[model samples]
Target: MSKRLANTLGIILALLWIFPVYWMVNTAFLPASQSRSTTPTFVPFGGDFSAFSRVLTPSFMNSLFLSLRVTLLVVVVALIFAFLAALAVSRFRFAGRKGFILTILIVQMIPAEALFISQYKMLQGWGLLNSVAGLSLLYVAAVLPFTVWMLRGFVDGIPADLEQAAMIDGCSRTSAFFRITFPLLAPGLVASGVYAFLQAWNEFTLATVIMNPSTKTLPLWLRGLAIQSNQATDWPGVMAGSVLVALPVIIFFMLVQGRMTSGLVSGAVKG
Candidate 1:
């Protein structure tokens, strides 16, 4: 294809992806009557913040905070565990190491839906249901295997020579790794962290099964909003809720997107 044509196609694809988000924002600002009117208003000229105000009431804010707590916990725990496990498998050749790597793959192969019953029961037995810790722990387990494997690839791609060079210059093994290889792994870490964050933030089925009404997360709260609306569905409120839920993800991407593309592998020798 011609360069111009390819560029056009890419722009078109990008617009297609962004249209839904635009629609959500459009609806969020629209008046309730305009939303349900026979003639749909594509643009919001005099946007009202009433729906947004209602969605931000204390109950909804509580769910938002709860979701944030779970997502943060998931990201931190999953990244730590993935990092150490990736380092071990990539740096060492201990017995059962190969099997351990394979097991990560196998564990990911098992569909999450299939394990919901057992997962719920296990948490219930441990008295973890409807709790932030319980939900975060489950999120970690859900995202860990794939994240570890992904980080392992990035780690394996980093030549050991850099760390060795640092060690020869009198740096301790830990310092050598921290000063040398860790910088190179930053992109992979950000990518993996984004994945874990999105999973924990957006996952509904597992959260629905585990969390109670009182401890609802954002997605769960959104679902409840949908059901509660009944005949007079609060499209504006729902869209407002969506925007609120999406803000963190968008801000996060903007923050890390630069690092994901630059500096992460800036000084690293790839093997």
Candidate 2:
């Protein structure tokens, strides 16, 4: 295809992907009566923010806060542990090194749902149920293997010679790594952060298993909203809640995208 044609096609595809999100935002501003109508309304012409109001109520806010806390905790803990693990695996060889990487792969292969029973039992045993720390610990475990694998790739992608060059110039090994090679891993960190954010944010099964009445996450709260039949399925409110849930992810991506793009470019040019 010609460059112009490819650009047009890309734009078209982008619009196709964005349509559903746009529709959700549109619906959230609508009243329930308008949203539930068989004939769909493209715009909330008679727009109202009542759905948003309900979506941000104290109960929903609690869920939001819980999910955000868990997501942030998972990202920070996962990144620190995964970054170190990635550096070790990439920079040094030791007994069981291969086995360790293989174990990460094996862990990823296992279904998350399969671990729910054991996870619940472990949390219950530790008296961690219905707690943010409990839920975040589970999320970190769930996300760690993949994040490790991801950061390993990034670590490996940076040539050991770069750090060696810095070391030859009288830099300590740690300083060489921190000053020379670390900057190159920004994209990797951002990518892993995005993955951690999405996984923790959207995860429901583990949350549902570990968190009870007082510790509900956003997904759990949304599920509760979804299951209620007598309330006539407040589609507007649900959509609003979803949008609110999505806001953090959007903001996070925007904040990291610049660094990610720059890192990609730097890596490409260096390669």
Q: Pick the candidate with the highest TM-score.
A: 1
- Could you give candidate 1's per-residue lDDT for residues 21-50 as a string of tens digits? 999999999878788988878889888998
What is the per-residue lDDT of model 2 for residues 160-243, given as tens digits with 9 covering 90 to 100?
998898999999998998898989999889888887887899887788888886668998898887787955889899899888
Please give the CA lDDT of all the candidate structures.
0.85, 0.84
Total backbone collisions for each predicted model: 0, 0
lDDT of 1 at 156: 93
TM-score, per-candidate, Cα-based? 0.87, 0.84
Q: Which runs of model 1 end up more than 4 angstroms from their true locations?
A: 1-17, 251-271
Worst 10 residues of 2 by lDDT: 262-271
Estimate candidate 1's alpha-carbon lDDT, on a 0 to 1 scale. Answer: 0.85
Residue pairs in clash, model 1: none
